[model samples]
Target: MTRNRVLRQSKLLCAKGVFECEDLTTLNHGVFMSVKRKMSDEIKSVWSRNGANSYKEARDVVHRVEWEDYQHWLDLQWPKK
Candidate 1:
């Protein structure tokens, strides 16, 4: 896939309350620990209202992200600092 498609899907998932995009490295696992963070009420409403299709699309994007082998991103996300 293309770079644009990956970014778009990540944004979609971020909007769904399924994930966050602020630090993208941790997402390599498909599911991130940060998913436990509480979303605002408005975000919750939008997340709940999304259809199964959206969930599937987000999953696909996640898989792609994982396959990309985020070595550099992981370094940035987990810098020695």
Candidate 2:
């Protein structure tokens, strides 16, 4: 898959709260420690929001932040060769 497609799918997966480093490895077309780190951070952030006002609201916030982070990562041209 193309880089853009991989980035987009990664963002979607993050938004959906499905963070699996192994999966990201495949999406990245190879092992990418930076991407793995970002994904790990996103998951940790989301998991940290477990005691918010409502689970749904917390999930929404996590998804929004994850998408934003993904966009930032894309803008940075991550997984630099």
Candidate 3:
């Protein structure tokens, strides 16, 4: 599939609270790990800013931030040719 179409579908999934974005399955292991760590930090920041007392309280916002971060990493890794 075309890159833009794939990105669009993945973003739709993200909008639906899908936290993982492993669409480009061949992503380097180290890079994936790095992105995951970055996402964790973003989640923590959102959780604090929103005063979320528990994982459940931070669920929606965390998922959205996680997806957005992951998507951004994906874009950087696979910039349009």
Candidate 4:
């Protein structure tokens, strides 16, 4: 999605009292789960289709997920309790 959309969603979530007072541990767990799911699918796809490029593909997928997770954290507005 675009930056604007993300900002909008963040604002809406905040307004709706969804993002505020969240449990940090739960949030991190969810992010980790998301990354794990993406990595699992990506790695399996690459490993099945091509043997030679599988290593590189898996690495790229992992890096992409890590970057995305970082971006996600950056976008969040941690509400003070």
**Candidates' lDDT values, in order?**
0.31, 0.37, 0.40, 0.41
Candidate 1 runs further than 4 Å off: 2-4, 20-81
User: Residues 1-81, candidate 3, lDDT per residue (tens digit)?
Assistant: 564465557657778886434333343433354444444534343221121112212245433234335456555443233
**TM-score of every candidate relative to the true structure:** 0.18, 0.20, 0.26, 0.27
lDDT of 4 at 17: 73
lDDT of 1 by residue, 52-75 (tens): 111122223321223343343244
Model 4 lDDT per residue over 1-81, tens place: 564465457658878876523223554545444444444534433211111112224445423334335556345444434
Q: On TM-score, who's better, 2 or 3?
A: 3
Q: Rank the candidates by lDDT, best first.
A: 4, 3, 2, 1
Q: Model 1 scores what on Cα lDDT? A: 0.31
- Cα lDDT tens digits for candidate 2, 7-34: 5577578888865333333323222333
Q: What does candidate 3 score in Cα RMSD to the true structure?
A: 13.7
Best by TM-score: 4
Alpha-carbon deviation at 58 in model 1, angstroms: 30
Per model, state how many residue pairs clash. 0, 0, 0, 0
TM-score of 3: 0.26
Better of 1 and 3 by lDDT: 3
